[model samples]
Target: MSSIIYTLPEGFTTGTDDTLIYFYTNDRPSEKNKVVFTKNMLCLLQNGIKVVHTANGKEIVTNEEVLMLASGSILMSEQTVANKYEAILIFFGNKTLSDFCAKRRLSFNEKSPSKSIFKVPQDSFLKNFCLSLKLLKEQGNSEMNEVKIQEVLNYISTTSPDIFNRFVGQALAGKSDIKIKQVVGLNLHNGLTTEELAFLCDMSVSTFKRHFAALYNMPPQKYFLQQKMDQAKLLLSLQKRPSEIYAELGYENLSAFSNEFKKHFGLSPKQFQTENGPGEKAFGLPEQQFFKDVPATL
Candidate 1:
């Protein structure tokens, strides 16, 4: 299980147990910031709207809606249409969910969805359930917090079996041996070291490399860098500023980003943007020779 605890800056209040709950409100609107979720996150939006960009697509979340983000990274930008941004959030680690499943005797036979973000369909039962948890917090019943967590899991299992199965599958996926495709695609935008990624995949460095090489027919490092470059080109064609996108591409500094771009595309980001028009392909998706051999999850 991941032990990374996300501690927000000052003015953010947190409640904790096996799961971490954050009550967040920001006076100022947020700029597009890169956020890495080390654990799966479920948020109930009480006010304002949040727009998130993942590798797959964009999601717009608003009040009365629930959003689930898989354990990975995303570029998030927020806007407050009327009031300040406020939300009740739970960050659930795999170990916690696995324990919950063990206690409930719940198991899933299906695979999780490949898309990183899921907008949970809301119902009256879910709304009342969330409200009851809110009341539990107001009443200072800290001892019942775990009960509330179980209630949420139980509600999901009964009302939305597909989502419940997906959650279960995700919980188990972290512990078992997953495919090379799942690990690489999910972490393409992540900046973890090779050793760190190997650890996350439950493999030794040597084993991870051997499997990765067998699948991609290339070194993992080189293959990932090429993928990042290709994604950068796509983002640039959409007129995103290099400064705004460099960090999301996992580059630490602008100079290095510029150097890498020039090396790959034969022009600086700005120059390329100025010279080449939009809708041109930088390259076509890194050969994709083994994609047919790999089936996407769900």
Candidate 2:
């Protein structure tokens, strides 16, 4: 079952369990920045982009988006983001999602919520699903995917992806004491230059260097390059947008993407994105890969 929670920064006021949390970051602009295209993320648009490098980023997705974490080895984020948002939300973790995928014939689209925003087309099942979240919350096992929860989640899979993503977001938000560290890659995944990293996070270069070593035992540039390369490989395998992959990983030019790709795997970004095998560009997707912690009870 899914229960909704609201996340707020310190000093923010809120209401009951049914209260909706505000998500927009004040500094995040609605401006359309340069878009990048690479291998997984090809058809989405992201908001709140602050480019630390060149003005023109990759042209990966086509619309402004709210990205969601879907799958993979990423365990950094506290919540998974999905593109193509909608009004309703549906979520079932680890077991529920896995079991349903195993038993049903469904394919999660690579598109963001901005694309189609799920469509339920029916309601008989919707009523039951809402009840499930409410009941779970009331019983305080809102995190668990009991047989009842699974039934509701799976039944609602036919509803809309938006509803599913919302449920997941809401459930995660509801938890008390969610640590900011739960977000995996704030500065970790995409390593930055000492100065660049310091600037983005609002710290001095000296402080940034010290913290970088304390966290990863290396300089920011090295960490950034490694993540850039790692993402390059995943972009190839997941078929994510080549250009966006470059920007997300901190590259400023196709040359940078190409050079890094070669340094890591002897292949250029273009060649890798075109490759149709694992460790190469296979499918493109948005939202940085991160493992949103799912309650063990679920």
Candidate 3:
């Protein structure tokens, strides 16, 4: 499937660098769009059906529910209602959250389940709060936008303590290594650039490169290429024709796939398949067997 990368805050022209509040609207339907959220986000959907796909599972959101998302990569699809889709997005970083909690002396339930995303039922207070944000946006009062975001967080803390604790816990958890693994594993076949991957992992390109090398024992590009080549070989061993599997492996065409396969394995896909018949071992063991031992980080 084709994918689009959306890097928020930088993608929009509203609000400050660290924290932003914007009224988001769309006139059409969008599906499977990859969003790299650099900051924690609170989304109040006024109209539309939003399907969010993450490592945990799929979540369907609507006007009756609000979505609280931590900084990460997620596949999102939105279907418009009445020819329009609308939501108010508030983006803030961990520092903003920490400051809000410290200023209020808010204590989280450490035992609460940490989740990267949350869907909470919208209440009257939240609805009114969203209305206020829309008014402020129209008034060009950027200063109050941050306060309004904090106000929503405070409201959630008091009204929905369980969800607030879980959301906050995940936001401040700081599990960088686990996050790197998840981001890399999920987007391996999605044709994303290293810069985009770094953005998804919420790290600078330099930091991501360093961490990637430490974890994978190789450069990111080389590791990705190796993995893709391995997959191509596995597909070939399964009796799948080169033309049938090249697109599945993200190659632009059969020629590109064959060229890379030859460079990596010293044989074209057809030549490899002929040399090692279907269902026979190619790498001294069954290709399926190799996948069984693949580590979670992969």
Please tell me which predicted candidate would have the highest lDDT against the true structure.
Answer: 3
lDDT of each: 0.69, 0.40, 0.81
TM-score of 3: 0.56
Winner by TM-score between candidate 3 and candidate 1:
3
Clashes of 3: 0
| Per-residue lDDT of model 3, residues 123-186, tens digit only | 8988888888878878888889767887888888888888887887777675355456667777
> How do the residues 122-171 of candidate 2 rate in per-residue lDDT, one tens digit apiece?
35454454455556656767345356545644655554555665433332
Q: lDDT of model 1 at residue 25?
A: 72
lDDT of 1 by residue, 1-298 (tens): 2334333321143433346666667666775576767667778877788898878789899875788766776777777767588777776766567555544556564465566676676577767876887787788776776667667767777777777777567545645333445556667878777887788777899998887776568888988888888778768766688999999999998889999999987999999877655554333322244234433321
